[model samples]
Target chain A: MSTTKKAHTTPPYELIYWPTIPGRGEFIRLVFEATGTPYTDIANETKDGISAVLALKDETATTSGDGNPPAFAPPALKIPGQGKDGKALVIYQTPSILAYLGNKLNFAGTDEAEKHYILSHTLTALDLNNETHDTHHPIASQLYYEDQKPEALRKATDFRESRLPKFFGFFERVLKGNEEGGGKFLVGGKLSYADTTLWHVLDGLKFAFPKELAAREKEFPALFGSFYGSVKEVSGLKEYLASDRRLQYSQGVFRYYPELDRQ
Target chain B: MSTTKKAHTTPPYELIYWPTIPGRGEFIRLVFEATGTPYTDIANETKDGISAVLALKDETATTSGDGNPPAFAPPALKIPGQGKDGKALVIYQTPSILAYLGNKLNFAGTDEAEKHYILSHTLTALDLNNETHDTHHPIASQLYYEDQKPEALRKATDFRESRLPKFFGFFERVLKGNEEGGGKFLVGGKLSYADTTLWHVLDGLKFAFPKELAAREKEFPALFGSFYGSVKEVSGLKEYLASDRRLQYSQGVFRYYPELDRQ
Candidate 1:
């Protein structure tokens, strides 16, 4: 058991999330890929690996074992030999995982203040990510898109006209304010998880609403022109994004419905 | 400036948020009150302190100054002498602020694993809080509830019948799994921001959907019977919750709209 973990820094850092669609899992996966950190994407890599993801939020299970409480949702990270008694430490929630990994992987900034700013920005990006999900499923996540078409249309329209501009304008200001970032980073000069997290949401947005994004792309020059383009070219991200490891967007947090786009 | 800050820890921890109504600001307030930490609620206390809150997300401004980037929203924390070159460090996002204060306030769990669990659970509780807000405004936040009444009814129905049960069950199992927690704490043997955060959301749910929460309260005994009731009696929370400092819910995240509540 110890031997397997030693090959990758003595801890098998495993990602447990739904198979396929990038969803929130991509936010966690991006950090590991960008830092060249070795990890296992349980659902995508192994047969029946999705059981691990299911178990994290199993309604009947009181705990996910190893003295860990049951997770409320997935995109949980399992690190062997990291728990209270060298057991696997499992943590769920995208932003929490990103903060933990970001700090450890050096993507969180140098100082304490920068670390939090990175988290603050990462959370805002995730908030936009969640709003994108709500664009198609405004009424309920369990219900089909057809059942909530009218609500989705109204929600998506408001999202495009009002919410997008509000979020985009705020992020643009963040990019423009940081003189050291040169319009690329949201926080300090170097790359942070906040950058990767925001970049993925933008990527998902482009896939989910190309027409709307294209029409509004030029509105926020710093966000679209520099910050969006620059993150893709970052060392490990450049390669992982091009690889098969980067899954396509479909039926997850982001979905491409022509009607939901800028018609 | 130094003299004023010196009285409260040499770095006046100021909470910049809208005056009146708890909204998301209550979550930040609970931590300060829980830990007996000295801080200022800028908008509620000071004359025209709301200008500082307004300036946080100023649409025309590129930055919030003192080297901080433009905040995406309010509930921002301003700490003097905590930024680069003693220029004041400001950060926004509810969970981010909670995580920072949770760690410092001794409300977050002791170890690395417990800390993340507390944060993960806090995020989930905040998710529920956000969902409660959506029950009253499903189509769009900017639109009045009357304009979106039809959709809010549908969303509120799903929230009561489905969403509430799922969240409640998850927290119940978390309390059951931790023997040391004894049904009161969500993580370790002590109370966490996760507990307080979840308590507030439940309190809001009671105010917002009295019938729904009342009918479903007994379904999760450990959560409602123990955890929910236990937190309010805790040291700081007991005193804080009983005082006028504990604001009532009105036109905020947990608004009491009988139409949106269960029949």
Candidate 2:
């Protein structure tokens, strides 16, 4: 396949996220990587990047103008304008950003039904992501994980026993039902943004709850092995995952709190 | 405006949700109400509705076939087929369902950017909804509100003091920045599904945290009053709210736990 020059020719898309953790930004990064889209990860690039990321949340910031609404949180994207007078559009909300990218990148599905299907899966992945994050911060996001450890243990148990199996089973069903794709991709036969999202969800689960996920691995052979294997084999994604850019899982959304994990 | 015959003329949409609480189903309900779309809240109608709702989660169920995937949770919509051979499309995820309804009901936006803007706002509303839900169930959804009351109190404090104000401010900014609608609606000048969602959010907040919300009511004049007032004035919605069909809020996503609330 010939490489698309759009990444090089067009102004680089700017992503504003926290400097340390991969967090929700990883989902967007996966999309950009899978599609071979060239973009600048702003917070990782400069010493003042965190300040720039926080400024978008500042109501008094200059970037808040030019008909743009202030982003509620990070992982905000700044896509270059089409014309001279057109200013960059800044939008937040992870699912919304992914949908915007999916539309622009043609990874969102082909028809309306397919698009909604992809969306449903993406939102489900996000739900799983939020639940995983809460496993570590069950009380409050502002509170220290140490302070909330007891509640986190309780929350993590329900998450692993109930939520994980439920979500994984749902994805497996989606993969199996995709007759158009022959059970390969999440949506149409072709790989879309939802596949990348599921891949991340599976990856995060494995990282956070290694023994528990491993125990259930045989339960979702298609989701854990085949579907996940396919996403990992995506040429560009394979390379990106191996690169230094793939931030290690730490105190981010999917933290490996050993006390919270179970067999 | 003439009442669109789409409600009665078309096959009624079947909504599969919990029979009791409004929960996330209310968001979808508001869309149908605003557009005058006829839908059967299945769980509320038949004695076997709860069984039917749970059957969707059963992997071995026959209805899971015929090209429909199992729903991850309730508030799943089963739209009647368009053609003789067409199968009823089953979709879940509140945002996705709302998007599907917005497209059919003409509440989504006129252009691509407008559609995305609406989506971004809707997702943010959902975030607020989730946070609000978490205030009552800070530890685990599986646990009763009473079981988590202490942690719930702590979580509710951060939510009311920090998260609620932040989200309300974001909505106000979105309303203020909408040049197309002149701040009358969330996206365009005319009422959309998102406007209904924002109205519900404000209403739920008031119901759950009356004192705190009332104290901050003047802080978000556009969101709390003007925009909300306009949404209430929407002819169809006005009638729907007055009708018994509008489920009273209790022990749902937004609940009135007096001990959890503060000024």
Candidate 3:
């Protein structure tokens, strides 16, 4: 309803994500920030914005539903427009939400080939996201991070050495492939969600394994440079970072566990 | 290229997966089977089908071309007649490929909501798949299952006790929500990719942890039953499972490490 209640209605999307952690929602939030689109971020909705999400979930938890339920999980998006029966429209899953937004925002590749390219890249970044989360919580998410600290140490070290290099290598290839656009962004002539995601991934790694990232930063100069430079320069992203909305890396997906960061 | 040669090309898509080892590709292979689509098993490309996978990775690693790189590690799809510039289309990442095929085959949901719902469920199955893989390769994918036996045992114990119940519980809720279609499918009135994925997840778990699965099977009777019933009745899957293309569980993502499986 925040998206609907707003006076200036250029953007009409409601995002329901955990207020305490940026986690998955940061990807979608970055896209909106980059595009300068207005979307209501219902952070920590239990006190404020979660009621809508809970209601939506309860309504769809049945068989006789008229429409499709969100496939699963958080980072759901809702367009305030009404349906045939005059209700809201919603979609979930970060990839699906990004795809829908890419389609809406025109960053999702212009042609079929481009769409495929965007989709493929999006999925690739998603893999990195999952792996990043698994680095700390490799054993289980329900269990506390402390409970799995030993496994986390081994996993994080491997992630810093093997996984980081591999991912940085992949993104470096993507950046190098951008020869069509003077070799700046990942796709086309301008920035896409892929670029934003790369920035997030790099930022997360830097926070989690600052020493490793600092040591290995020179290896992926192109990707690392573009990531650092873009985050600093992107006006909206700069603002988001400076603002309180961008949650600090704490107990979220990518945590800075010094013990786990050792070589 | 095989798809191009099809005369009565109504034959389903061409799935290029390892001839041996169910691995990640089985997710897509199962859907094609469930939907009764005709697809060629390119398992014979190499001496034992794994070389073919290696060749694909080689292309991913060394090949430099224009367009986004392949997503995820494996289980790429070659859709017939949809390739760009007369080339056979290739899409990677098991979940994305399954969702793409599900959409094309009409096994995905009817609308956006249904599509998200199916994706979420499939993703949870994928999470389960990841845990199964970690049971064998806990330290790193670069290390062989045998090399990581000690780590695998530690990881698997936690997986069986904690992770299994979480994923299984999610599936149970999904199945229980099937009030219109009975508690047999994961989504909507008909079978979706989630159901097939659930089948494969349960099947792989049963194969890898027969003793553990058998002990807990009765506790999740509906989920266990849905796994068997869905795959048995699925059209092409039944044929595929019986054929040579259906690889064994050895050396794949989900391996039978007895030490890890034992209580």
DockQ of each: 0.86, 0.49, 0.33
Give the candidate number with the greatest TM-score. 1
Which pairs clash (backbone N, Cα, C closer than 3 Å) in model 1? none
Model 1 chain A worst lDDT run, 10 consecutive residues: A1-10
Model 3 residue A9 lDDT score: 43
Task: Put down candidate 1 lDDT per residue, B152-181, tens digits, no spaces.
Answer: 999999999999999999999999999998
Candidate 3 lDDT, A1-263, residue by residue in tens: 21222336455677877667878889998888777777888755436686655654452353213344433456777776532254555666687778777867776765655565666677778778888888888776777888878777877778877887777777676666566644456666667776777678778878888888889889877777765676557767788788787778887878887787755
What tens digits encode model 3's per-residue C-alpha lDDT throughout B148-192? 676678778888887786666656656676565577776667778
TM-score of each: 0.97, 0.92, 0.86
**Clashes (N, CA, C under 3 Å) per candidate:** 0, 2, 8
Worst 10 residues of 2 chain B by lDDT: B60-69
Q: Could you tell which candidate, 2 or 3, scores higher by TM-score?
A: 2
Question: Model 2: residues >4 Å from true position, as ranges?
Answer: A1-3, A8-11, A46-51, A60-63, A82-85, A179-183, B1-3, B7-11, B45-51, B59-65, B82-85, B179-183
Per-residue accuracy of model 2 over B110-148 as CA lDDT, tens digit each: 766567667788888888988999998887788898898
Prediction 3 global C-alpha lDDT: 0.69
Stretches > 4 Å off in candidate 3: A1-11, A50-72, A80-86, B1-14, B43-52, B59-72, B79-84
In every candidate, what fraction of the native interface contacts is reproduced? 0.88, 0.50, 0.26
Let me know the TM-score candidate 1 reaches against the reference structure.
0.97
Q: What is the lDDT of residue A221 in candidate 2?
A: 83
